[model samples]
Target: MVGRKILDDKHGGKKHLYALNVQYARSEFLKRDDQVLAIRLQQEERLNARKKAAVDIDRARAQAGQDGEPYAEPDPDLDEDVPMDDIAGDNFGSKTIVIHVGSQNLRLGLATDALPKTVPMVIAKKAQRSEADDSEPRPKRIKLDDHAPSEEWFGDEFAKEYIAMAQDFKVSRRANKRRVLPNSRELVTKWNSTTPPETIPEHSDPLRIDWTELPANEKAAPDYIVGAAALRIPERSRPRYHLYWPVRHGWLNEKDYAGRNMLERDFFLILEDSIKHELGLTHRREWSQYSCVFVIPDLYEKVMVGMVLQEFLRDFGFQRVCFIQESLAATFGAGFGIACIVDIGAQKTSISCVEDGMIMEESRINMKYGGYDVTETFVKMMLFDRFHYADFNLMRRHDFLLAEELKGGFTTMSDENISVQMYDFHLRAHGQNTRKYTFKIYDEGVLAPMGYFRPAIFDHSDKLSGRHHLIPRSTDLYNGHPNDPLSKAQMAVISYVNQAIPSAVTAPSAQPVRPLATPVAPTPTKNRPLGIPSHLNGDNDPTPRSSPAASPPPDDGGTPHPTGDDLNGDEIGELKGAQPDTEIIDRTVPVMPLEQAILTSIHHASGMDERKRRDLLGSIMLIGGASKTPYLGQYLEMKLRAALPQYPKEILVAPPPRELDPAVLVWKGGSVFGKLRMTNDSWISPLEYDRLGSRILHYKCIWHW
Candidate 1:
C-alpha cells in the first residue's frame, strides 16, 4: 500500500490522497502461504479489532465515571476548534503567526500550527514574459497635468489617472530617503524617524525616487484628459516611481471580506520598501497594491531566493522560518522506515542519514549523479546510435532540434513547438538505401529521476548534441572513480533493473543457491532417498543403475540436469525443501530489520560491545534522501530479523505523517522533544554551542525524543 500510493503519485497527480493502513491491512492475510487461510485469518483479525475497539471505548467511559456520555467536559478548550484546525485551533490571538516561501510555481504555506505546507500559486494569473520587440510602432504622445508631459513617462494610463478618477484611491510616496512607501504604522514611524532632511546625493543612488514637479491645471479635466496631459512632464534625473494603493475587497461589506488580499497588499508594500531602501538599483519604477499585499514589480528578470521567502512570509504572516532539506522531507513523507532522507532531485541526488528523526553528520552521502547525467547519457547514445543509422546527413538538423525541444520541455524556456530536420545520408549519399530519416524528441531515448527512482525515456533535446572542442574527464564512461564497483553496479545492473522491472526485483537464481565452493563429492549420510542402502546390490562397485535405453552423454557438452533420485526428492514434499519454494519472503521484513537488529545487538552484546553502543547513546536518528526508497523497509526488516533471530520480531519503522513534508519528521520530532513542558530541563541552542562549544551539545540517551 505504501508503494502503491508513491507509485501512483510518481505517474499522476490524482492518486496522492489514497491512504492505506498498511500494517493493519497486511496482518489479515496469511503469511504468503494459503489464500483461503489468509482470508479466514483476515476476517478473524477484523472482528477481533472491532471487538477490541468497542472494549476500549467502554473501558474509557467507565474510567471517566461517565459510562454513556461521549464527552464530559463542556469547557471551550475541550471543544475541537473547527475554524483553527489548520492553524492550531484558531483562537486568532495576536501571537498567532504563519510563515511561507515558494518558487515561481508553488507558494509555500505556513501557520502557527505544527509545521508549514507548501501550496502552489502562480505569481501572475495567465501572464508570461516575452522578448522585447524593438520594431513595434511608437505610441502617440500625451500629457498628464499641464506641467507634466506624456513623452517622458511611459506606463499604464490607469496608474496616472486612478487618484483623480476614484475618490477612494490613495497615493503614498516614500516618506524618507527609503524608496518604499510605508505599509503599517510601525513602518511609517521607521520611515519618518530615518529620513534625512537634506538629500544625501551620494548615498541615495539606488534609493532615489525623483519626481517631476507637477503644476496645477487651469481647469477641471476629464479622466481621459489626464492621459494627454502627461506629455509635458520632464524625466527626473533619477527614475520616477509611485506606490499606488487600491483597496477593493475590504471596502465592500466587512462580513464578505476574505482578509487574504488585504494581508498580501500590506506585507508586499512593507517588503518592497525595505528592499528598495536597503538594496537600491531601480529601473522599472511602478508597483501596484491590492489591499495590503504587494505584487511583484516588473523588470526583475530573475527571481531571487530571499524575495521568494519574503513574499511567502508576507502572504502567510508567519514569524519564524526554518529550512529543511527537500529530500529529507520527501523521504519521511513517503513512509520510509529509516529516518534517513534520500532525495534524487532534478540536478543532484543527495543522501543524509538521520537517527531518531535527526540527520546525522557522519552518515551523510551524496553524489553528482542525478537526472542531468541520465539526460546527457541519453543524448550521447542517440547521436552515436541514431545518426549512425541515418549516415549523418541530418546531423546538424538533429543536434539543433533535440537541444531546443529538451530545453523547452524541462527548463520552460520556449513555448513554441520544436521541429528537427534529418537527412538519410545512408540513402542519399551513394543511393545505397531508399528510406527517409527523421528525429523527434519523444523518440530520443533517455532516463530521468522520478521521485526517489529513475525512469528511462528519450532525452528529447537537440541542444546537448554535437562534440565540444574542450573534452573534459567525462569520456571515461564513469564520471569519477572509474574502477569503483558501486559505479559499475549502478550503470550495469541496478539502473538497468529499475528501468526494466519497476516496483520490485526478483532474485535471479531459481535454485536455493549459496556460494558453491570447488566441486566436492557428497558424503553418504544415514538420511537417504527412500532409505535405500548404498551397497544393496553387493560388491560395492561405484557404478550401478545405467539404463540401456538412455542416450550416451555427449562429449564437450554443457552440464546435465540431475534426476529426482540424485536430488533426494523422495525425502522432500512438492511444496517444500526447494529453491523457489524454500523461501517466499515477507518483503517488508527485509529493509528496516537492520536498525532494530543493530540496536538489539548492542543491547544484548558482551561488555565491550555494550560499551561501544554507549558512544551512540545520544539522539540516534535516520537521515538521508535515499532512505525513502520503497524497498528499504523490507531490506532493513530482513537484516534485523537475521541479526536478532532469537528475539521477538516486532520492531517497527516510523510511519509517515498525514500532512507536512516527511523530511521534517525528525526535525519536528526534535522540536517536540525540546518544547515539552518540563519542570527543569536544559535545552540546547546555537548560542549555547557558541558559548560552550560542541561539549554543550552532547547529552545522554535520556535526552533523545
Candidate 2:
C-alpha cells in the first residue's frame, strides 16, 4: 500500500493516494485487488487554458510569419513527495516589530500594517561635509573593511534588495505586491509537477507552513519576527516602564561630592541618587535586573560609553546589570560586514574598527585628545592674541575657567570689539609696586573649550608667526578708509609669513667701538677707486658708499656725514677724473628663516606614512563640545595636507550639531548601536553563546596587522 503520497500530471491535476494499513484494511474491504487501477479521470482543467495559450501563441507566430515548435510533455517522476507534516500550519498576517539599538539609546517600533512608520526607519548616522571635502585641519584616518560597500546600507532600497534575493530563492512572500492563486487546485498540482520543488515553496499557503526556521534572508522581511519569544509573553506580563533622567560624568559619581547644583554633580552619583530615591518612593519591592551591554567595540568609544551609561544608570532603580560593549553589539547588528566606529565625545575620544562591527581588541585606538583640546587652544589664542592686543603675559594670567567665560562671550571679531571692554589699571600686590593689568569685563564668545570646536573667530592659524608682534597695531584702529582694510590685511599676511619663517642668525652682542682719525670719504662720479667704499666705511656699517669725507665714530660713538668730495676717487683728489664704482650692499635688512624642527613636528603629527595615514584616517572623528570653533575644520584640513602627502582620499569628519548638537554624536552613535536587533537567527543564542564564550572572552588579539 502506498503511503500518503501525492502525484500530479503536467496538465495540472493533482492526486493524493491515501492507502489504508494492510492489517486494518483486511477486516474492512471484502475484495482485494492487487493491481494498478487505471481509473478514467477528466483531463486537467488547465488543458483548456493551455490550449487557449497555445492558440494565442500560434496566432501571434502566424501573424509574425514565425513557426512554433510543439510543446514537450514533462516526466511524471519529476513530481516530488512532500511529507504531510511539512505541508501544514500558521497565519501570515501578524504585527511586525522594528528595533534599533545604538551605543547611547534604544528604541523599539511596531507596525501592524505592512509598512513601517517614519520613526522606526530613521537611524542616526552623521557624516560631515568638511571631512568628505578634505577641509579638516588634522586629517586622521581609520582603516575600514576593504570589502565593505562604499555606500551605506540604508533606506528602502537596501531592504528591497534583500527582499528580491529572498524571493529569488522562493520563500513564500508577498513582497510589495500580493500573490494570487487560481480557483482550481488542479492548476496548482499541474504547475507543481512541472516546477522544481523547494523545501519551502514560494506558493505554499500560509496555512501549510511553519514560521520558525525560515531563511534569514526571507525572514528579514518586516512581517517576520525576532525570536518570536517576545511574542509568547503575555502583554500584561510587564508594565510599561520609562525612566528618563539627565546623565552626569562617571568621574564625578565615583568621587562623591556635595554641591548645590545636583545636576552638575557626578553622573554616577545622580544615577545612584535616583535609584535610592526610586526605592524610597516606589511601591514595588523589586525591579528587573539592569544588565547593560557596554558597546565598547572600540576602546575609546567603549570607555566613553561605559563612563556615561554607568553614571546615567546609577540614578535608576534597577541594579545588578550586565555591561557589554557596543562594539560587540555592532558585530551582531551588521551580520557579516566589517566596520569602524569612531566615537568622538565632549570629553573623550575613541576609535574602534571591527572586522564585523565587533572590534578585534588589538585594533582599537583611544586617545586623550578630543574636541575639548581644540577649543582650549583656540580660546586661549583669542584671549591672548586678538583680544589682548598681543599681551601674552596678561593672557597667561587668565586661567582656563576665566578664559572659558571670555570665549563664550567674545567669539567673533565683532563680538570682541563691541561687547568686551578691557580696563587698564595698576594694582598693588604683597606690598610690591603696583602692576598694570588689562581685564576683559564683558564678552559673549567666551565659552568653554566645547564651543570652539566647530566655528570660531580664528579658523586655523598656526600660531601667527611669532615674528609679527602678537597683534597688529592697526587691528585695534580700524579706519573707514579702503586702504585701512588693505593695510591691515597686508600686515596680517606679512605677520603670518614672518612668523612661519625660522630665525637662523642672532644679532651680535653690543660691543664698544674704538675711535679712529677723521677719514675723508671717496667721491663717486667714476672718480673713486674700486675699493674706496670698503676703505672709507666703518667696520660696523654694512653699506659704505664712496664719497668725499666722512669720519668714523669718536671714542664716544659720534660720527660725521660724508659729502661729494669724500665719495670721489683718488683721481678726484687731483681735481678731475672719472668716478670709480661705489656701489654699497645693504646688510641691515634681514629675512627670517624656516624652523625645520617645528615644521617637522607639524608634518609628522599630520598623517605622514601610508600605514600611519590610513591608521589616522581610520580614527579621525570630530569631537569635543568646543569643536564648533569657527574654521577649526579648515585648520585640520591644512594639517592633513601637510601630513598625509600620499593618500588622495579626503579625511572624513563626523558632522556636529549645527544641524543638531554634534556633542551628542558619540552618544547617539552608541545608542543606535545598542538597539540593533540581534535575534537567534543572526547571533548565537544563550546556549550557543556559552559554547563560543571561551573563544570570545579569551579571544586572542592579532597584533601584527
- Note the clash tally of each candidate: 82, 128
Q: Which stretches of candidate 1 lie over 4 Å from their true place?
A: 1-88, 91-107, 110-318, 335-339, 385-437, 440-705
Q: Estimated TM-score per prediction?
A: 0.25, 0.29
Most accurate candidate by TM-score: 2
Full-model lDDT, candidate 1: 0.27
Give lDDT tens digits, candidate 2, residues 270-313: 22333334223233234223222232223221223323333333
What is the C-alpha RMSD, rounded to one decimal, of candidate 2? 38.9
Residue 429 error for model 2, in Å? 25
What is candidate 1's lDDT per residue for 15-58, written digit by digit as tens? 55556777777686535533433234434544564565567656
Task: Tell me, by lDDT, which candidate is best.
Answer: 2
- Name the runs in model 2 displaced over 4 angstroms: 1-268, 274-286, 289-291, 295-297, 300-344, 369-620, 654-660, 677-705
